[model samples]
Target: MIEIKNLKKVYNDVTVVDIPHLTIAKGESVGLVGNNGAGKTTLFRMILDLIRPESGEIRSNGEVVAGHENWKTYTASYLDEGFLIDYLTPEEYLYFVGGLHQQNRAQVDETLAALGDFFNGEILNRGKYIRDLSKGNQCKVGVASCLLQNPQLLMLDEPFANIDPSTQFRLKNMLKDANKSKGITTIVSSHDLNHITDVCDRILLMEKGVIIKDIATNSSTLSELEDYFGVGQTLGSVPVAGIDEEENH
Candidate 1:
């Protein structure tokens, strides 16, 4: 379980994230939805201890996250390409990540073989550095790497942003099956409402750093999200007319 209380972050005198209280139970799949600057990534950073919050605290499996390293044993996160080693080949990177979790090369190779369809023949043994791979392929590598250790808590930010349609569907199915069979506690942020709705059991709509709506995924969830983000309706905050006020002035 993950528990957050009174979490907060500030930059340039603006609150980027402020959550009074929240909890994610074990095996739950959650989707975070928001426009740019809604604090999705920021929140993830705080949870992973990549950034310090001004106040409050987060707990993972009854262990405090901040100033502690125990949670790292069970938590695996992939937020962006920055989380990957661009200088290494995809295979090398996977071995490195697996090593951190005590997974040997042979074990890592076995895991990669099972994900053949997800890789689509473009990732492993390509003999190209991750830096040279296309963004979509790099994303595939990153996503696959996160699943290598079979972490109990997995977090990915915008897993569908840069990928082919066929790969996207395959990835979604992979995540769904992982969640069902292993009951991995999963959290993902995405701008794609349909994809998010399809993979997650719960969705949180964030605006200006606060989750204003929490809806359980169902047949109507996609349309509901579309209506909320539709033009003329606020995506949480920021006056529409004032968008260009700073530039116009």
Candidate 2:
């Protein structure tokens, strides 16, 4: 389980994330959704201890995540391209991450096999370095490496941002399988509300630096979510109030 209390983060004296309390249970898949600059990424970073929160505490399984001895073994996260090794091939990078977790080459191969066609043959024995791979392919490599460890807590930011539709579907299934079979606690952030609604057990909506809404999928419909997000259409045309015109331009 992951517990967060009075979490806060600031940059240049400006608050970015402020959550009073949150608890994510084991085997649960949660989605964090918000407009750009809503502090979703900041919150995820704090949970992974990649950044220090100005004040508050985060604990995983009753242990403080920042200083826990086994934190790296239990947690795996992929936040951005910086997490990948620029000089290593996809296959080589996976091996490197597995080695850090003390997984043998044979075990790493077995785990890769179980991921099936999620990589779409892009992460195989390619001789090219990770920097040479396309953005989508790089993302696939990062995701595959993280899952190689089969961590108890997994956090991913924009997991499907540049990936193709088929690969995205495969990733969704893989996450579902991990949650069901291993009871992994997963947190994902995405702009695609459909993906979040399809996979997550619960969803948190953020505005600015605060989470304004948290709803369980079992208790809500997609239409309800669209309404909450203020996304709608009028007479087959997207509503101006709901559209992010600036982003589109």
Candidate 3:
């Protein structure tokens, strides 16, 4: 579980994240949906303690995330290719990541083998460094490595982006099964509302550095998200294509 209090991040005097409080429970799959510059990734980075916040604090499983080392033992995240080592082969990167947890070669191999479906046989033994892999495959490598750590808390930003549809589906199923079987706490941010809603039990909508909506999954949740992101809301100058086709002509 994670707890955040009065969290705020600033850049050049502009407030990018201003979360008063937020809590995610253990074994819960929470999705964050927000448009570009919506502060989702900034919040994640702050949680991982990758970016020092201007104010406030975060605690994971009762461990202070800032200025602490214990939380790393239970946390794993894949935000972007920045998380991957481009020079190393996929296998080499995974092995290196697993070794951080003190897992041996056999353990790492077993974990990769178990994720065969998620990897789709394209990642391992390809004689390709991570930088050489396609962007989608690189994303897979990053995600698979996170899962291999057997993390108690998993953080993935845009897990569906760049992935083909079939692999996207498999990734969702893999995440669901992982949460069901191991009680891993998952935090995912995606622009794809459908994928986020499909895998997450709860959803948070962010805009302008604040979580404007916290919704529990239900039949209507998808539609609600659709409408919010759809045209006619006052989200400032974001044009909706085909909203009025006749006028453009």
Candidate 4:
């Protein structure tokens, strides 16, 4: 339940994000795929009100996000390690985040228990501060913290990066479950085409601060996207497996 109208963000002398209008309905799984400097993270920051848009507005659940606090209660995002409390141990940080949502230590532990597969036994009781963990482990911590909040709207930037393949597969399932079973509105921006296609039903292709193509994913979606990005099988690279193969994983 998010809407953007005339949204634009600029830096110095260059426009980075210039979306005119966009909408994401409740329980929708949307993917944003673009190369570097495509303004995906900028758009996400404006949506979260972490940065003010130069023009236009973003509304969550019909309320202007620019000057509102209500949406914060239902929204959870992890853009980078910057979102983590690096000095705190993983357990301490997660518990602290859970407390912010009024969840007790017991509840936080319960949530962590359910995420054991996602964590792959590296997060809890590690005796290591979040800052000491690898980038992929740090990503796991951030994502786990978000899930502990049980958010209604979840946004992740480049979630598939800096993680192992097994963890990536688990993360995709988690997002799918959140959208289909719990009805969470999910938005993720990623560079990996196969992962994004497997996780999101709809895809937004962005370039030079604008949404160039809004595609409803289908059997041929991956190939079509590859063609646009010039990464087609004709380029002497192995073609990624299709959606059916994604499920098999």
Candidate 5:
């Protein structure tokens, strides 16, 4: 569903993303795990065409993504609150997004209703603009908007960061269902190793702007990642947080 070739992005002569090649198949759930400055978000932004790569190219389906509009129709993403319209209420923002896909108000409401568990009653009818909500609540709104689009390819960056445990569980289930049942291809970048391993079928470990490992998830995948990050023995049962957040890319 997506492909990258010799992709590279740099700032101030420092290389941030240097992917030689990568492909994500349709209906596959792939996790991108990397420490800060590993270029996960930079890779995502290139895929979304939010920023042009200094070199190389990204393609969705068969078309190059750099100068294309077709991919947007089947793709949905949320990297941070910057993706949201801070002045708009949650309902208004969702409804506006639904309308872009030709869905009516009732359709948007139905989808929101189905997401009640994910929202945990913290979103919807809150009567406040998106900016007023807590970061966790804002994340819920962002993710809900993505689901509303019913995208074929979904990409989220650090989605597990601000949310609580219950919401995290709900999100895992939601992503799993979207991939297994709905056949939506997913690419998620996260620091929480346990959740990423649970939700993704494949894992890609990145370091210093390059993909260092691509492993299919199995019973021992989490431990393998822990070992690489040098925390397997010391952090038993605790989530392997990827090295500190990457400086804004």
Candidate 6:
């Protein structure tokens, strides 16, 4: 379980994020949604200890995340392209990440094999440095490296921002498989509302560093979410909007 209490971050007199309390259980997939500057990235960074929270505490499995060695073993996060080492090739990067988790090269290869065509075969054998790869290819390598260890807690920020449609589909299926098979607790942030609606068990909407709504997908539809986002209006019992019209057709 992940528990956050009174979490806060301030930057240059601006309160970026302030969450009184938040908890995520094991085997749950959560979607963090918001427009730009909503502090979603900030919150993810704090949880991963990449940034220091001004005040508050975050605990994963009863241990404080900031100083806990277990967090390194249990958590795997991909927040930005900078997380990858520019000097390492994709295979070397994957091996390094696995080594940090005490996994062997054979295990790394086996894991990579399971990802199928998502890596385009070149990722494992490409001799060039990560810095030479394209942005989308870099993201693919980063995500592949993160999942190589099968971490219990997975966090990704804007994971689909630059990938192609086919790779995006592959990633969605891969995440679903990981969650179901290993009971991984996953948190994802995306600008694509359809992606969030399709993959997230629950969705949390943030605005200007604050969480405005938390809705469960099991009890809600995309239309309800559109209304909540103020992208459309509710006409009587139905949502009246361009999206609803598109859906009907």
Error of model 1, residue 189, in angstroms: 0.5
- lDDT comparison, 1 vs 5, better candidate: 5
Segments in model 2 whose C-alpha atoms lie over 4 Å from true places: 231-249
Give me candidate 3's TM-score against the actual structure. Answer: 0.91
How far off is residue 72 in model 2, in Å?
1.8
lDDT of 1 by residue, 75-140 (tens): 888898998999999988999999988999999999999999989899987799999999899898
lDDT of 1 at 48: 98
TM-score computed on alpha carbons, candidate 5: 0.92
Residue 154, candidate 5: Cα error in Å is 0.4
Q: Which digits, one per residue and each the tens of the lDDT, describe model 6 over residues 133-213?
A: 888889998899889867898998999999889988988888887788879999999988888778887777778887656
Whole-model lDDT, model 3: 0.86
What does candidate 5's lDDT look like per residue over 163-206, in tens digits?
99999999999999999999999999999999999999988888
Candidate 5 lDDT (Cα, 0 to 1): 0.88
Model 6 worst lDDT window (10 residues): 235-244
| TM-score between candidate 6 and the true structure | 0.89
Q: How many angstroms is residue 149 displaced in model 6 relative to the true structure, after the best TM-score fit? A: 1.2
lDDT for every model?
Answer: 0.86, 0.81, 0.86, 0.88, 0.88, 0.81
Worst 10 residues of 2 by lDDT: 234-243
Q: What TM-score, over all chains together, does every model reach? A: 0.92, 0.89, 0.91, 0.92, 0.92, 0.89
Preferred candidate (lDDT higher): 1 or 6: 1
Which runs in model 3 stand beyond 4 Å of their true positions?
232-249
